[model samples]
Target: MAIVKVDNLSVQFAAKGGIKTAVAGASFALEQGETFSLIGASGCGKSTILRVLAGLQRDWKGDVELMGNRITAGKRFQGALRREVQMVFQDPYASLHPNHTIWRTLAEPLKIHGESEIEARVAEALEQVGLPSEAAKRYPHQLSGGQRQRVAIARALLLRPKILLLDEPTSALDMSVQAEILNLLNRLKQLHGMTYLLVSHDADVIAHMSDRAAFMANGVIERSFDRAALVNGEHRMAHA
Candidate 1:
């Protein structure tokens, strides 16, 4: 069975005396261990789609199903379904708490989910992201941009999510740090057998890492590409 499925999903918002559609009807499915990337220009509703899948924005019309269970838009998704789907935002600095140490930040999710052995898992999660155990003692300001982002990735992985929603995860980092984060994401996917739903505007980033690439324009999917077509840039979709 597909781990995640979105059928005829659409999202709209109330603008100045008019309703604007942020995401038009779109449909897709993700299987186990698959990396599907959505690439598009700004205002193309990429983040809006991720928000719908993450259950952060519920004011929408669609059937979002995970493991055969339907998800209600804009509602607080709970239970195992919530844990199975996790998101890593683009900004690590804003995502991490300035007051909390790395250990506390990473352990917060497990604590919220009532997962035991938080300490042990925090250690393991850090190691998985190539961060040292000593990193637990530092605050967000103490680390570099790359290190902070890795910590954000580690925090998401601490939940051991079945499907990861990454929204331009490496966009804010330097080129060198971007490569490191990409490598870490690729490695972690293999190690945990997790499916990834990555959203980015960079074609090269999407082409190099994703097993399949889907282009979004004006709130709709223009095309989907396989591995070979992505590398060759020979797909029918408009490259944003």
Candidate 2:
């Protein structure tokens, strides 16, 4: 069964003069433990799709199913169900709290869910993301770009999410830093049994990390291809 599924999903916004549709009937499915990527040029609604799937944006029509359970827009699920899906954003700096230490930031989710074993969970999450236990004591600003990104990944892993939505995760970093983050993501997937829905404009990164690639245009999915075909440029296949 598909871990994540979207069918004919459409998203539109009301403009001053007209209605602007950002996503138009996009559909796709991601199986358990599969790494699927959405690739397209900027302003192609790649991030928009991720936002919708993460339940951050409503006002759309479609069926979004995670592990056979339908996700309703603007509805709160149980903490366990909510924890089953986690998102890592494009800018780690912005996503992280400036005032909070890494320990506080990482522990917030567990606290919110009333989990008492925050210390052990935080330590494990840090280790899983290749960070040392000392990382938990530092503020977000004290870390390098790559370290900060790892903390973001660590926080996501704390929940042991079954699916991870990665929105242009490495776009803000340099090539070297980007490579490190990508490698961490791969290792985390293996360690945690997580499925990834990675959204990026970089063809090279998509080719490197994804087993399948989906191309989006004007908020719609145009096609999907196997990873081999994508890296070889066989997946371009004449866009409409």
Candidate 3:
């Protein structure tokens, strides 16, 4: 069962000096309940592809399907479609509201979707991310980097999304904190049977978290690798 299907996707930006191609003719698919990663150096179109799938960047040419439904460019995602997928951004500090309490942050999504039981869901999400309920009372600034990122994860999980698009989920954290967040993500995915589309530059992170990975460069996916092959130092790079 393929949960996400992208084909011939291309994105360009109108920079001050003419246009810049951020993603060109990229295509990939993600199976349900599996972790798929895109690995490459910075500015290699990995994050751009993630944003496109998340429906944040809609100006692109291609076919994007989630759960078998085609997602047309420029069509606003609403109701069930919007709720089915959620994204966890790269920068914890930037992604979260500095002044809002964690409780408010977690509850906002439920409120937008007109869902009831906000308190219960928020508490459960916090617990699921291994954060104490008291942590919800604190502001983003009051929490550690890992704790803040956990809150971000908790916010995404509150909606019970089927697919999670992660962008460098632990890049800003310390090594120990990175391990903790990665483990938390793994546990949550297993418990919820969720699918993941993670983007990162670190091969070790890709090996630790992904079942399969695509190496992206120069606005295209160059090659795909199984986790075992990547871990064993065996990979073949082919241009897209």
TM-score of each: 0.95, 0.94, 0.96
**Candidate 1 runs further than 4 Å off:** 235-237
Candidate 1 structure lDDT: 0.88
Candidate 1 per-residue lDDT over residues 1-240, each given as its tens digit: 888888888999999989999999988888878899988779988999988888788899977898778887656887888888889999999999999999999888889889999889999999999999999999999999999999999988888888899999999998988999999999999988899999987787888788888888888898888899888885435773
Candidates' C-alpha lDDT: 0.88, 0.86, 0.88
How many residue pairs clash per model?
3, 0, 0
* Number of the candidate with higher TM-score, 2 or 3: 3
Candidate 1, backbone clash total:
3
RMSD of each: 1.5, 1.8, 2.0
Q: lDDT per residue, candidate 3, 193-227, as tens digits?
A: 99999987666787789999888888888888987
Which candidate leads the pack in TM-score?
Answer: 3
Summarize candidate 2's per-residue lDDT along 1-240 as a digit string, tens digits. 899899998888898899989889899999999999988767777888888877777677888888888888667654466789889999999999999999999999989878888999999888878889999999999999888999998888877789899999999999998998999899879977899999877777887899998888888888888967877875455232
Kindly report which residue stretches of model 3 are placed more than 4 angstroms away from their true locations once superposed.
235-240
